[model samples]
Target: MADLIPPTGRVHWVGVGRATGSGLGLVCDEAATVLWGRTVARAEARLEELGLAGGAEPRALAPGALARELVPGDVVVAMLPAAGHPALAEVALAGEAHLVCPGYAAPGLSPHARRAAERGSVLLTEVGLAPGVDHLFAHDLVGAARAALGDRPAVAHFASHHGSGKDRPDAFRHHFDRAPHEALTALLTPARVIAEGLPRRVARPWEEVRRLTVGGETFEAHPAGDSLPFVTTYGLPATWRLESFARGTLRPSGWNAAWKPVLAELAEADAAGVAALAERLAAVHPAHDADRDRVVMSVRLGVHTDDGTDWAGEWSLDTVGDARESATARLVSVPLACAVLEVAAGRVPPGLHQATDDPEAVRRWLTFLTARGIVATFRGDGAV
Candidate 1:
């Protein structure tokens, strides 16, 4: 079997569902292998599809069983739903397994993070694109702002367009049919480490679709999810005027408007209603099928110095699936693959760490991905 980790250290992989498997399997080749489930037909099919060939067996996600075989669960890659994560995050830390993922915010991350830190095992989340790399980009901007002004700026604006291009809105409805609640209609969701001061603002998802025109192309974004936490992570002052948002990326015109009705109705709809909405939307505005999917991210930061002079900068990244895989899978999974390796190599720290603290890791990931097809760019390099 491909064992990218040491022969003696085995990784217990949980939630080997479709997208997570795609990501977990990529970083693990001959170094450290998944201790269980490799031989299962579905896993085998996935591995075979992803260009990995191994003879490892699939086992249920049991800490005891895994500990017996892999011995002390030193490393784990979890793809369980956000709600299911905290308990497992706790278990993995207790087992001494350094953990990582590309997921959105979860209550579990902060709680178990402390235990992982005391134990010297890392627990990393939001290590993927939007939440992950996007944070890293925020740190860079803050660093630049400080370099220019010698102190934190008085005001900053952060926003993003992070969404999916589904086959049909309900194309993946079967996946969420059972969870009638907790859909995007209910929730919403950046950056950097001065590691001291943070300016924060919170808003519901898509509630305020801030409009913008970039490179002659206009798009919209909105505030969502705990973005205020970043103001602290970046070491901005409480008085620092900060506004940040994360929204779905869209086409130049009418794309967001096209789906606004469905999303508007999301709160009132059950699973069936949501599914019907997606299908109906697809009949007129269909998502790309079989063709590669893509994620386009833009992080724009505006800093107004205490003296009132203003400086602004931006970072843009566009990635699509390779001929071998989907971009959504790659953007979400690949950085996570490298993160697992970081834990294995002792590069990342334990405790609820976000991707922003690891700039070098981010650079390496972006570089490696570029070799495969991801495109990343930085603008207004000097204003930083």
Candidate 2:
């Protein structure tokens, strides 16, 4: 029996599920010590697989009890769903433990963030692949553009595209790295994005698709979630001609034609209907443990000055997973894992925040990723 001990200044992984646990397990291998808190058989199986079953402490405890046991200086990595975040964040705040997650911060995260700030604990969210890495690249590019022009550019356009699946197409033409239910649910979720300097609700996101070519392969980019908040977060000048700013999910070519109608139906479906749809989709796109997944990300920033000078910059990352983990999981988890370690080491500032825009921090994080065999490159004139 593992006691719900207070902050020993160690890492605590609060859940062990199929999609997220493998990445968390990789972090466990890197950390000096970790408390593996989970309720599933997969938890034990993963630890044994990682050769840490004998070393890492595994506690099959509930989240509430586990929260009470955390203490100041502790790093709590929540590997659960977004629905469970606010409650767990409240506990981490009370325990004064730094909280990090690969998921987006729920709307209810504000209060928890405020309390965490008062406690001097950092609550960092959106540290995964698409939102996380995309945020970093966007911020860096915007900053660089402003610096080059010696002022905020008169016009700024920002866009990001990222996605993952099998290197080759299958029956469904795509596969999900996460639970099919989660993927299906997200397909219909409405988001507010900025387009031509106006806020718009994108109910059927796949309808707004942009195409791109990476490594000689074509992929379709569709608006995933809102991009307005990030435009502000990146500190792009509102006074500038902010023509367009959007973050989108990337998929193989022809994905838009295939998924558009399917998402339209899901948007009008009830809970039961959604469940049924999820089941059908899952059956067609069941994950294969032996399959190697890939992650492709591209972020672009374009700015124009009245002086007739124009500047455009872009950052791209394309990686494939090895035997240890899926490319999707590794890309999503490693940045988060690095963030957790940095928080525990007293390097990260204390506060509720989204992905960081600090240049040095971004550089350090990217360097870490490059060392892990991730092929990342920045190409732009006078770009940071």
Poorest stretch of ten by lDDT in candidate 2: 1-10
**Per-model CA lDDT versus the true structure:** 0.57, 0.73
Tens digits of lDDT, candidate 1, 1-384: 111222134565665554553556655662466634434565565556766666334565544665454445367767666776676676665565667767754565776655666666667778777777677666666666666666554766655455444323332321232232343434422222121234434443444455666544555554445454555565554555665433334443444566466567865767677667556544554334455455567766766767877777777776655567666777777677766766676666556777645446656666765664556677864442
Provide the lDDT at 299 for model 2.
Answer: 90
Residue 173, candidate 2: Cα error in Å is 1.6
Candidate 2 lDDT, tens digit per residue, 1-384? Answer: 121223345888766554453456456665645545455455677677655675566776664667666666678887777787887787777776778887877586767766666667788888888668878888788778877775744777778888887877664568766667787767777767778777788887766677777656788877887777776688886557877778878888888677766777787889999888888877877777777777788898888887677888999988777677677767877777777766766776767778787888888877776776666888898352
- Assess the local accuracy of residue 32 in candidate 2 as a C-alpha lDDT between 0 and 100: 48
The 10 consecutive residues of candidate 1 with the worst lDDT sum are: 188-197
Of the candidates shown, which would achieve the greatest lDDT relative to the real structure?
2
Q: Stretches of candidate 1 above 4 Å error?
A: 1-9, 21-26, 35-39, 55-64, 166-207, 214-216, 237-240, 243-252, 267-289, 356-372, 381-384
